[model samples]
Target: MKTIRLFSVLLFALSLSSALSQAAKPATVSVNRIGDGPIITPELDQRMGGNIQGPSLIKVPKWIENPIGQYYLYFADHRGEYIRMAYA
Candidate 1:
């Protein structure tokens, strides 16, 4: 009886810890730089997502440009559609 009680307590504690760990996991998010520059930050990266509606901006690394240094700002919806605004 004592052994069974100890096992139950241990199991309960383990389950609780597991639940807490799962809850502690960080949420994932998509990020993009708004305005007229490149976004370079982990927080921004996490915040980026599809369906982004904003102005024309340039993404970093320089090679992704078409000699004009401009890219449309947009986000992908859950359906993976690119919703972007044109540069004016």
Candidate 2:
């Protein structure tokens, strides 16, 4: 408990000092839309039915077969009747 408290106090003091030392400035960030809408939609791709769910997107590992973008999406519908995947 004593060690944890001391660590916490030290962390808090360090963070406070760092925050005080840094000057506040406006963020120089821009929002550029890659696309107006989703790449795959029910209207565009009729393969999928309604109630699409469980979308898990991940980057392909170095060992695995990487696609053009090295990323893929695993998705299923609400009923989970079928699982579909798309790579880019």
- Over 1-88, each residue of candidate 2 has an lDDT whose tens digit, in order, gives 9999999999999999999889688789765779798655667467687678877878788787635668888888788688888887
Q: List the residue pairs that clash in candidate 1.
A: 30-47, 30-48, 30-49, 31-48, 50-75, 50-76, 51-75, 51-76, 52-75
Each candidate's root-mean-square deviation in Å? 12.1, 6.2
Off by over 4 Å in 1: 24-88
Model 1 Cα RMSD, Å?
12.1
Best by TM-score: 2
Local error of candidate 2 at residue 83 (angstroms) = 0.8
Local error of candidate 2 at residue 43 (angstroms): 2.0
Best by lDDT: 2
**What is the TM-score of each predicted model, taking all chains together?**
0.28, 0.51
Q: Give one digit per residue, the lDDT tens place, for model 1 in 1-88.
A: 9999999999999999999887966789788656985332224544445334343454534765454435544434444444433332
The lDDT per prediction is 0.54, 0.79
Query: How many pairs collide in each candidate, listed in order?
Result: 9, 1
For model 2 the TM-score comes to 0.51
Q: What is candidate 1's TM-score against the reference? A: 0.28
